[model samples]
Target: MPGREARPAVEAQLLLASCKGGGPMQKRFLFFLALLLIVSLGLLAACGQPTPEVIKETVVVKETVVVEKKPVKLVMSFVPSGDTQQIITGGEAIERLLEEKTGYEIDTNVATSYAAVVEAMGAGNADIGWLNTFGYILAHEKYGVEVILATVRFGRPYYTGQIIVRADSGIKTLEDLKGKTMCWVDPLSTSGYVIPRVMLQAAGIDPDKDFAKTVEAGSHNNVVIAVYNGDCDAGATYVDARRTVEKDLPDVMEKVAVIAESPQIPNDTVSVRKDLPPEVVETIKKALLEIAQTEEGKEALKQVYEIEDLVEVDDSFYDGFRATLDAAGVNIEELAK
Candidate 1:
């Protein structure tokens, strides 16, 4: 009875064995083997076909090449003209001129303050710059800037400083400004402060110890307005600013007259970093001095500096400026202080 009962279990085992021997597993294995044989036969048949001798020839091939391009860049900066606002617009004109002359792209920068432009030069932000006599001196002393060209005023390579007062106020000479209020355009202004100070000293008056009150008007036009509006008894600015104020703001200009004019001071100049390549600097200097010969260049010069030409000048021209500052006993160190 036990053997007969276990007969069902034995039949089930035999069924499993039959399934393992003839299931989809065996079919899949057979199918795979047949496909592999077909692929092998196809490869053998393909190998029996002839390969062209021309196609089998060995040949050398060259490698591909590539090149990198460099970028062109230049930056020019200048302080605002004391009154004309020409320095800002003038910079744009000069940038165009430089591009035309050198075929190099340039970006122009304008500083509200001349000293700030000098700071840009020290920081290596401006590749080329325009600076007043005092600003140029500071840059040369502090940063070794090289002066390349200077403006010609009244057909001379230098300009003058003028102390002005209201035409009706009767402040007629350097002596008259004593014990009176005064407005100096800017501390770094050569004619506006430095040269005027020298003129005052020549008359035996000290600007710091003499003026009842001193104020910095920040621009030559502001200095003129300060005098015209009776804000100060006298105002000092570059002599050239008077002409611009007369042309641009005639009413305001008519109310003021020059009471005293300082001795000749070298005009503003264009400078480059001393470390620049001499050849490049020379090229730039040549273009600048020669600008007056071309129609566009002449127009730009008139627009910016209001001059017919610029001349190549050396640092020696500024020696008189330094001497004038010294003669007045004005220590630039004290000015900064």
Candidate 2:
């Protein structure tokens, strides 16, 4: 500790004796060798056991162990305009299950419009999303969104849109509403707007130019309300929205009746951000696939999404939607832009 104070007299005497027996050249070599040995032993004795090298190695190992313990956060975005409470309830259940299964915390964001979900995906606001068929089509075309799962209602991968009217109203069919007021849900909604619009166009009626009044009610529930309250002669909305109405607002259910049913349209799909890591995407796909198999999950999903299950399907299901729009001569590119 005090710098090897005055080398011990005994050690000095021994070193001198060893040097005395050698010629001048040998003495110099012996002196240097003795000095080297003394310095090495002093360093070893001062460092205690396991040396500085061992301590540095232990620190490096501990640092690596700490780095390996970080957790992953996965964020999901879903539609949130109606029965938000039910939506959050179902979403959190799935979030908790996903966290348990994958060991990653689940974070969720609710988008007011289907188009807004697309925007969230594009802006990197969410790692996964629930998007309507119309938004799915637009996202695939413009944002390259990756569809990993499809929600099925009543054990089918597709659902329908029913153009409805007050049962007492004179409107009986698509043609009967030619000069009547009509309400539309979101523009990027498959059953709410796109499919219904396509069906109307097929019957030689132009909703924009021929209707007496065209109003946007923003959501499927709003469209139902508009028609039920006589705010519009007819309204376009997804069939599941009618279920929500029957269960939540029975008063409206008794007032409206479906006069026209659009052809089956694919239900919403869960899409992943294109840039998400492959493993994370796989984990999401697995979690979604499991949701339909469990009892509580099935019930929660049915209440919020009316989804009996989630099925794996390829991108081809949406190709028909594109074909339908193309047949109508509608420019989706312009709409998404």
Candidate 3:
């Protein structure tokens, strides 16, 4: 009986050992070989298909674009007129005229003071300027500004500076200003100060040493008004200064008397920086002359400078202005600031 029991257990062990033999190992090896064969066939089939060709191409463009550039910008500086709004509006109008006539781009600047415009010329900030006779002299001699045109006010290429007194003040001559309070518009005024000073000297009176009090009334209109109001015994201003205040003081002409008249004075000038191209200068002058011929243009310019026309002129026309300054012993280098 014991032998029979051990015989069954031994049989079980033999069967288990037989299961672990070549059958499972051969099956696993065959499976891996089949998988590798399938992978190889897939790769070969993929390689057998025709490969697509790559093509490169070049393209050409055949159009051209041409650009036209505009002219250089021109900037003009101004010494302000009586009215601020009038000065600005008139300046813009004139800039428009320049552009329309010259085919140029134009801009404008109204300097805070007359000397500011002069300094702008010296610094090359301005290409053109509106300068008074004395201011033109200062800019020409010191800053290389050239007068291109002379502004004509009231149809005259020349004007006169005057010494004015209230009509009742029996002060009839320049000598009467000797021991009295004197008002001068400003040192820069050719008519108001410079030319009148020369006139006073020619009459054998020293403006510096003779006057009891020398007052700067600030402007030509103010100079006339102060004399008319009896604030000043006598004053110097442009001969046309009474016209400036005629509307305000309708009897301005009746109230103020011209004690003396200065020698013929050149009108204000239209100037340009000296280094500008001559052709360009001539073009500007031409445009300005055309502007003068049109009534609307004159009316527009009148607000700024009372200019009715622009006339051809030479620098020699201002020689008298220089001589007057010289006769007064005025050192421009000292007076210009």
Candidate 4:
């Protein structure tokens, strides 16, 4: 056929042209043309084929963070009205209950004397104080300590001070106490010293000069023990304080007799420093009231200060007691100084 004859003729022409000794430039041009043609064919073949699939991978990372918080802390101080160790144990129990209720860390301590407790509240070292009547008065006047609660005993918000003496001492009357040795709880003690002193003055006897020797027994329990042991001819304490020692001294009630009882004195107080936060004070008051209702709290209160219950009170609660002190010529300002 004509097509087959034309293809052989073109091949014969190309072979003859290549066999001829062409110039170097002409041969280079021919070689480039051949390469260009081959590349074009390759591109056409590639375009005709299907395209390949491509995949991309991604990596993820995560981060975590944590935070820590610290608890609020408070300081509570107690007046050593009875045994020091026993008071401390009770105070600790109260601290735990308060901490659990309020979610605040509480530290408790019993001061060596009533004045120490007052001073601690004044100096901002103690946030809470268990203060006696006279001590509370002094603290309130000088430092503006605020009373939040009053302790109850024998179902009474008020308690009386007693002038106690051994049954065999023959000290049947306040006048008979003259020229006799006397044991006092502490200078700042309300029932054991202050009110009893007022009682003595009303009877025409001076506590400082009438007694041949006066001893500060440091605690009501100590005063009771001192009188029972005859360390002093007579002593003063809270009414019926002899029962505190009845566990150890079974004959304390028989050996020590109450010769006299002072007029009604306000019970001890649960006071707070003047600068304490009002919210904190309220929290403490609420926590204590709740704690007092529990059996554990009742036992703790009994151990700390023979407290039967706690009742809310204010600065006015001590007004009658203050008037009695005023009439008795006891100056609060002077005592504070």
Candidate 5:
């Protein structure tokens, strides 16, 4: 009985040890299963959530730039009709006035001859011209130069050419000019050469052969001075050109006498190049018209060409003069050639 009891006790002891070992194994299994469950739940939650969207911010920088502009420059040319120095001074005054009126830079030039001014306009070297009547006509025919204004003198729109001689020279008629030295302003001069030549021809005197000597004095003032100084026996010029030298020679009016006077000739013109911008042409025309009404403008004009005022006119204004030239057998194209 003792041996049986002892066997039973040993068996019980082994069973107790088995139970204690089994308890630790069961706890480890439960802990591993719970960790796997937690990992699976976190993955499921991550799969249910939306993907994050990245936002980008952009910044723009602005820069400012500036450019400078230059003013427009216009060249105005003139024919030397009187004292070159006086004409230059007057031209500069006009330049200043126009610059103030138009806000454009103005440059002034006095050409050596009328044709030079016309050619400068045609060549685009000049934008404006103060042209004599015949010079304007020639420029219009050749380069389509346009006349915007005609000069007024003593309230008259027309002037006459006079053939001058010393008061005691006894050259009373155009016939007396034959076999005498003759002075002319220029071949292109309207009153100084063209009309006077026509007068000589009408008198049945040949200008080419009748004169003992011919001189081109280059300007109206020079022609008057030449006649007064006895360098020329007779000369042609604009009516009363002697007054130009009256200050220097007080006896100029007394010494120089008018032998004959031509018919009415249209006054000189303020003309522009053909290719000039229409707006610019209008501005120039308006400025000149306004300037003529000013006292300062009047004095400057007097110094330039003895201009009394400026009157607006068109090409038709010269038609009468053209007809006269045609009737006299004077061919403008031929003269141009």
Candidate 6:
């Protein structure tokens, strides 16, 4: 093997070239084999070193990962308010305001049904909503929606549910409503169905059974119009619902009368999906608060819900709604049906 040393070098070069080109699998396999051989040789060599004294302390290594923030994009929905386009036009203003103020991308939807809005939140299609108090509770209970803020109608943060009758209708009191056609708004409507039902039941009238017939008018305004036109003997709606139609039905005040009013209920809620970042919730609430401070903003708020201010409301504020539902024997889950 005097001049044969070059044969071993040539063999090594040929073996490396065989594994290197046009064959990733082969190359990787060879790499692992070589790594295993090197590890085995290293272990053999390490046996010659004297054993080191064991240290009593354990060392922990921490790793930090930096993730870039993604752009905040969301959709907002509201239960339909008779004028779907008006809600859109008004909601669009809030979208624009939010985009400008918080750098978020927002899309607006005026949901056809209150339950649809709740579904939107649960399905992750909607990140925020302008929900009536009962709608919020249903969404919160069923879908984990988190309350961000509440609306102030006109100037107060609370309003009453009123059962109104035509001004000239022979019906002067709740008793007169018995065996008469009654109009109710959506089932999800707090002021439209739940509160007025409670009022009727308190007066010894069963809305489901006593009324000659009951029909849904869809929205508060429709409930008012139904009574104004004598289409129904009586209808339930939020207080001052007649005022909302006076401009169109100029005799709205003269034609409609509030026969009974429910106790003051908490105002509608400005809610976000529970999974939303707290900062995003704060940003949205802040932008809405700022929206109520200017003339232009005031007009936008008015178009949405005649809102004058947005105030922070915690879960405790909505506890009364729960009590009312329980006391009336209304099942929150059944309403979803």
lDDT tens digits by residue: candidate 5, 33-89 = 555655655565566678998989897988878777778789999998889999999
Clashing residue pairs, candidate 5? none
Measured by TM-score, the strongest candidate is 5
**In model 1, which regions exceed 4 Å deviation?**
1-69, 251-254, 331-337
lDDT (0 to 1) per candidate:
0.77, 0.79, 0.81, 0.90, 0.90, 0.84
Candidate scoring better on TM-score of 5 and 6: 5
lDDT tens string, model 6, 152-270?
98677899999898888878899888899999888889999888888889899998899889998888888888888888999998888888788899989987888888999999899
C-alpha TM-score for every candidate: 0.75, 0.77, 0.74, 0.80, 0.81, 0.77
lDDT at 298 for candidate 6? 83
User: Model 3 lDDT vs. the true structure?
Assistant: 0.81
Candidate 1's TM-score reads 0.75
Better model by TM-score: candidate 1 vs candidate 6: 6
The positional error of residue 123 in candidate 3, measured at the CA in angstroms, is 0.7
**TM-score winner, 1 or 5:** 5
Lowest summed lDDT across 10 adjacent residues in model 3 is found at 1-10
Prediction RMSDs, each to the true structure: 15.9, 12.8, 15.3, 9.4, 12.2, 18.5
lDDT of 4 by residue, 1-337 (tens): 4464355445544644664568887776665665565565556556667778787778777666666677778899999889999999999999999999999999999998999999999999999999999999999999999999999999988999999999998889999999999999999999999988999999999998999999999999999999999999999999888988899999889988998988899999999999998999999999999999999999999999999999999999999999999999999988878
TM-score of candidate 2 to 2 decimals: 0.77
Count of backbone collisions within predicted model 3? 0
lDDT per residue, candidate 1, 108-215, as tens digits? 877878888888888788878888889888888888888998887688888788888888997778888889999988778888887888788889888889989999
lDDT (Cα, 0-100) at 153 in candidate 6? 81
